[model samples]
Target: DGGGVRGLSSLLILENLMHRLSPEKDILPCNVFRLIGGTSTGGIIAIMLGRLGMSVKDCITAYHSLSRDIFDGPWRPKAWQTSKKVLGLTGDAELRSRRLEEAICHIIARYLPAEEKSALFGEEEIDPCKTPICRVFVVATQQSNGRRVILRNYPIPYEASRDMTIVEACLATSAAPFVFAPLTAGPEGCRETYIDGGLGNNNPVAIVLQESRLLWPRQSVKSLVSIGTGARVPTEVKQNLMSLAKKVAEMIVDAANEARDFESNIRLTEPSIHSVYFRLDVAESMARIGLAEWRMLGAIAQRTRSWIFENHDLLNRCVVTLGGILLNCLCITLRYLSKC
Candidate 1:
């Protein structure tokens, strides 16, 4: 789901779902889903929708602008940076980290009110349990150690300190190696560097499930929707060390296979949950689009639209099920109001 520019596909799918859910007016995902989590580019999307309370259409537009602003320029790595890339060392990225930070800041400023903007983007720590809106979390990997950190807008069951700001969380999660420089931020003494979480936990469905259990120990999940950018095509590696290393690196960063394997495992272990679990992904056409192909937005949108059309029945079922849940919640709220 962290496929650089291919994030358009994920947004397109979400747009369709949101439109189907409320054909009349705009409905934000923050008001619908109790918990949302994603990695890398998906993490950015999660923040826009779940944390910022952005409508699907507005989020899609912001994503387009962000993609163009970030990827429109040419990237010519320095000689030393090229060598570092080949040797698997951290070096200068293809794009400047400042560009990404600025773009995200622009979006935050555009969407948030004046009174609330500073608090969300400032260095002040945010306790997820104290957030008034829906619970949200984004995954980012520690640069020093390969540990996965769950940057949450809600409480984790454990005793983890809330030391990160929302802006820092976004930048840290979106710092894909070789594409964007790793982000270094925090208080003076405890500053830490972070890169994209896709290298380890790309799909993030497992993380959502795990954290959901910790957040609500006795409750059962009624619906879990996992949307993907698209399926990746497998490539044959040459019989050489360099080619093998490159191939291994690609596999380690890619999440398509991991998503498929997890879905398969869910089907095998908990077939009964199939009725509640929904996975939507573009199966074909996207295999050829590279992750950094920002110019291929039109193509990605077309492919995702076609996939949605072909799977109308599944989408309908998902909409109906979620609508039922929404209606039930509304009824409970209405009953409480009547009692009051």
Candidate 2:
């Protein structure tokens, strides 16, 4: 059923199937990963799954989203052809660029399972021609170490992008590409195929699955997945999302325990579209993670900062906008509280 694209990424359809087709079925045993493709549902489902020791490979990477030719790479076919381009791959621009990105994907691929190549770009049946907003963000992850790693910028091969250093990327980019977890309330069964991709839509189901981390999916598991595909522009709504994301990031600095690494401490994978997209919804995001609510966490000292520096970026460099930060913080606090 999960072919490579948008494979079973729909929570709504899944729930519908569960509710109408066979409400008595339990999917928890399937080891089946579902991407909620949103804020609230996906996020919370991941939270619960984390407690179960299941690892989520999130599709919604922080600041990455590109239609790379992931197949058999000489690499950077276009970036290399351009006058201005990335450096240091030892070949011509195209060869270098292609090799570079391919190398990167390869490097990360090493740590990931063979099945999670497009963790975020999980694939879907959505119509790519949709008139709605099409998103391809740099997928971000909330590792078990309390870090939000930008999947694309991971430094196994080299430590920088064409624009800046890894550190800079982490700081600046962490604020934008938000992570999402999907979930569902009431549901039912579905056809052998469900979660149909809307044609002329940017909301690719693959991206949604990638975002949901339903199959042991992580926070926005692999790449930046699209939320939906529609022509209607609710400008006010878009502005609100930007504002909300920004505010959550600002509050993150003082809200958590010692900063986390790219690998979040509590890793989780949400299942189903309804669950995944629901978590991403701003209201649900806030209500479930409580990242919007600022509390005094007693600023972690500069020594901690220096420790990070001393490690030459080896120790911890992960950061979640505000949502992951607060979630990790509360988890950290609870850990100590229990120990005490």
- Among these predictions, the greatest TM-score belongs to 1
Question: Model 2: runs farther than 4 Å from truth?
Answer: 1-14, 29-31, 34-41, 49-340
User: lDDT value for candidate 1?
Assistant: 0.77
Best by lDDT: 1
Q: Give the per-residue lDDT digits (tens) of candidate 2, residues 16-85.
A: 2223222354333012222222222222122222212122222212101211221223434333322121
Error of 2 at 303 (Å): 52
Q: Give me candidate 2's TM-score against the actual structure.
A: 0.20
Q: By TM-score, how accurate is candidate 1?
A: 0.88
The window of 10 residues in a row where model 2 has the poorest summed lDDT is 191-200
Write the residue-wise lDDT of candidate 1 on 87-125 in tens digits.
766433535567778888888888877667433332334
Question: Candidate 1, clashing residue pairs?
Answer: 128-153, 128-154
